[model samples]
Target: MQSSGTSSQLDNPPSYPCEKLLVKPWGWKWRSSYWFVTFVVWLGVATDLLVYSMVIPVVPFQLEELGYKHPASLTGWLLFAYSGGLAIATIPVAVWSEKYDARKLPLVAGVVILIGSQIMFMEAPAYWLMCLARTLQGVGSTMVWVVGLALLCDETPPEFVGRQLGIAISGVSLGTLVGPPVGGGLYTRFGFRGPFIFGIIIAFLDLAFRFLIIEGKSASKLRSNTTEKPNNEIALEANTNSLTDIGNDVDVQNKKVSFVHILRLLFRSQRALATAFLTFVYGIIYSTQEPVISNHLNSVWGLNSSKIGLVLLAGATTIFASPLSSWLADLQGTSVVIIIALVLSVPWYVVMIIDGHLALFITAYGCAYFFASGVLSPLTVELASVARSVDGIGYAHVYGAFNLAYGIGTTVGPVVGGQMYDHIYKGWLAICLLAVGLLGLCVIVAFFYVGEEPIVQSFTRRIRLL
Candidate 1:
């Protein structure tokens, strides 16, 4: 007969292979895993935005340094090149990330690309080299953004998505807040090389954070004896009952959807299409502000790069409002929050039109940024909801399409805004009017097409019952 110890060993099998069960790192614990991943993703996004914005305040000086006769037009083209690269890379990266079942690799590769682009920017010998650098930067940005966001969605619970996304947006705002001033200050003291050195340092830091990220699947495999379920299988199982409860007819649980089919389904939902359009317009409004505000400070106010950077700081302050807005979206419904934000934005734009003073301009733009921040998180939450309602496999593609729409807006905004600024009378007024019209369209679309029950109706019903 076998000894008691031997029999006990055979009876209680190991939960995981000996080699795989070595030790759990700090991030691998189930309790802290999601938060750690979210923080890393947030850092990656902040670093991308930091690097992108760092170049903005100094663009004019760089053009002049390179002896360009028309820096204004080239600036627009430079912005276009970046957005074009992003538009080209986003969908491909999204598809790649989905197929691989790991976002960590792509995240690292993107940061590596970012580091190389910054080095090129620092050492660029010709205008073409700078353009090439910007394009590479855009590609890196697209990879990070698309993969990072998909990863976040994959890890996060559906109920908390809006708040989590809001937190991510705040991280972005922090980067935007810090980058311009730091870049401009560095340029003022040490010229182009300084900001790029700073960028390289941050890129490495971001890479380190990405390397430490452990996907939930990998963690589960380490912690359990049985082979873990595929992430898609888990996601489908989790969503099936909710989809059925909502009266969804898509049958996404077992379906393998093509990208084109995903697109078709999205378009068929008027709500989804409207969300996409609003996202596009939101991109236009924000991207248009960067070039226009920088140019306005330079040409109209004769401000130095450092002062312009300080002025831009006003916009970043609005980031603090993101969590509050996200909470409001969760409580009041995303549609109601969006409609209220749009209505509030009109007055801010009107104020901008009426005031040319530095203080007034800063205040108006800050308020505009505050309202704009409210739109992004809610809209993203809505888009994700719509995509899941259509096809469980379509979440990654939905985000890809959102990025594509935003990329197109980024390309169009600078080019059109620059041309209008150069050639049209009261060009600022024209841009503001366009913004108003776009906001009106979004409000109408949200009112009629988006399927959320009206917050007002819900409140009224509760009151009637009482």
Candidate 2:
């Protein structure tokens, strides 16, 4: 019989990627596992949005408490500052991520930034300082959103990417809907410092999870022998380094392009541009509801804090649509799903304009929320598809563009909507009209450009069958 020492030496061990280490990382299995990675990304996204919005209801009151006039306007500008930082940081972050192929580091660094911003927001006394803190928060938020989603895409399968992304995006629905209530609840009980303190705690948890994730590529590298690599390992490596290309009209392997050039070509593709516009419009719909609509509900309907929270909570109930949207995207094509959602949502936006019907208004908001949440998955999946079609473009790059579109929407939504609401009579009408117009444009764009073939051609073919 072999001795125990000989038996122990016979077992093959995975070598770490580092020159120094001789074995797989401790906790590598869970740290690099698919579900675990997805959960981390989901939490990463939820944490960012949770904290970003945790102080939403409280911001106006905080400003008023600090003796600032026109608290609504100041709140809008603060959101503008956040969006400004998001817009400004996206490109540089994208470039660096692509160049380095590192996600977790930036993600950790981002959470740290978010923590600092929360502390600043909690302690700052002046309006400009608040703006500065919000801007920093935006920067931190961009890091998580762009890189966290990219990391998810990296770990997921090609066919299931849409569905998986939809699941992750459910975190957005959770964070957005839950944050204000949680914040409002804390405010009711504990006053000014309550929300920020909670935010810091959640962000710390996020930082730890982000630190724990071992990327798929790195984990794959731990296999010292090619024969020892499993199918999953092979698939993961293929996602990054496969010779076979999908898109036509370019030699993907031989033709090298700069990030800017790849981005230009991506935008030139009607499919990508349409999806980007859809994301932008979705951001507008979401941002319009927060400070603007919440304020409207309070001012017009005389809603107390609890009533306002209930309305937003009602809106979030349809988050179930996210999974259905993802499945529809994978099955029928994302373009079709987006088109259907946008069409169904139009009436709801129109319905929100009616002032006399609280129950009806609540119904409209919930319907609108369902469709809005549905739209995000298809847009996310579509953008990833676009990036795959082009050579030298990565998830990081496209997601940066994604963040850029969202930034513009969030920035313009509040600033312009707030201005119209504050300075103009019938400003609610203007905001409604604006949302309706953007939705109409998105519908047309998706019909023409969001699919493998224009949806009108499919319609024409179907008509012939009839």
Candidate 3:
């Protein structure tokens, strides 16, 4: 005797024994809370970065211990290997995750792979094996990053995405803040195997957290109905929907869900292209000077691994600004935030040209790192926005491409920077100049082509009016 509206609204509950006792998953409400999902992404990113940078200071020494000549060059090669793996995996992972509607599966699998990499790095007898391990690390990390960000995009609302992403990205900042000191200290005290053993344990913890989390789509399987009607009632309700439901269905149908089509729609946007470039630069900022920094410090100041880690720590203090930068980008638009951060970073890179003041250099370096870090959240948000603008485009397609750009940057940065440092005259100075020039290029492009409405379009509008 129920109305069609009521019948149509009912969800199908399990018709087994104690069907009335069926309920939503235990603690389902909080496990999928806004912050929890963000934390999972944050933790995933943080763990990967932490594990990567944690071993950086130890790499040259480890190579030296393995009797490899020119450990610095080898260190650069290892970084290149890592990046190459990331680049190689980005497309496949993105395509698969989107095609299969999966996020957590890859995330959990990635951590297990990450743990295997750490163990291999800790025990690998040959240099090539170590390289293979690093490459594997990159492959594993990309899965977490590509899919995790896409998941974040799914859970977060459009208006708040930028800020939430900033918060999640702060985990990268935290990882950088903590990783080096811990790695260096552990290595200095306990040798090469110490830090990675810690890493393995941490990876397991990350795996557990990811396993516990339930994505929104997966949660749809849970039972939430209070009224379970007969089979005839279900039949009657199957064809009926309210006007709002019909409208939503039309909207879903209107969106172009084809992966290739969605990708093409994003590719056509200038802002998305510019954001991808910024992410590439982000990879460069973290990787290029990194291989050289520990060597430069050891040669110039005779600092040990522990002390060098402390120095890197001092320079990374600027990472704290990411949240503020994301908030600003949310408020003022991405172009302004991107421009200001890069411009301020220019003077700091110039400080690298200075000769022999460790404290001063660290201050400048940290300041530069801070400014560079600010751009990521904004770019991430902007890139996601661009994809969202394309009807039916998922976040994975854009972030997959995002990971590819970053992987390329990571590969390009260490190899080029390390080679230049090894052979070029005033190479550090040259690198500084190059960084400044690239920053300028980024600023120019961002001003003209980035954000909600680029400066170029406004200028074009004015000329047309004239």
Q: Write the per-residue lDDT of candidate 1 for residues 1-466, one digit (tens) a residue.
A: 5798777756664343333444567646743376776788778878988888887889877888878865656777788878888888988887766655557888899999999999998999888888899889889988666787777777788888778876776777878888989889999999889999998999999998888888876676556523455444444544674566455334333365566776677778776777778888888877765666666778767888899889889877666866777788888788888888877887787777664688898898888878877787787777777766765445566777778888888888877776776677877777777777777877777776554664555667799999
Cα-based lDDT for every prediction: 0.76, 0.80, 0.83
Clashes of each: 1, 0, 1
Over 369-398, each residue of candidate 2 has an lDDT whose tens digit, in order, gives 788678888888888998788767789888
Q: Highest TM-score among the candidates is held by which one? A: 3
Question: Who is ahead in TM-score, 1 or 2?
Answer: 2
Off by over 4 Å in 1: 1-17, 30-32, 225-255, 454-466
Task: Select the stronger candidate by lDDT from 2 and 3.
Answer: 3
Worst 10 residues of 1 by lDDT: 13-22
Clashing pairs in 2: none
Q: Could you give the C-alpha RMSD of every candidate to the true structure, in order shown?
A: 6.6, 6.6, 4.3
Q: Give the per-residue lDDT of model 3 (tens digit) for 197-316.
A: 988888898998898788875454343334565744534444343454588667756653666776677678877788888889878867888788888888878998999889888746
Per-candidate TM-score against the hidden true structure: 0.86, 0.87, 0.89
| lDDT value, candidate 1, whole model | 0.76
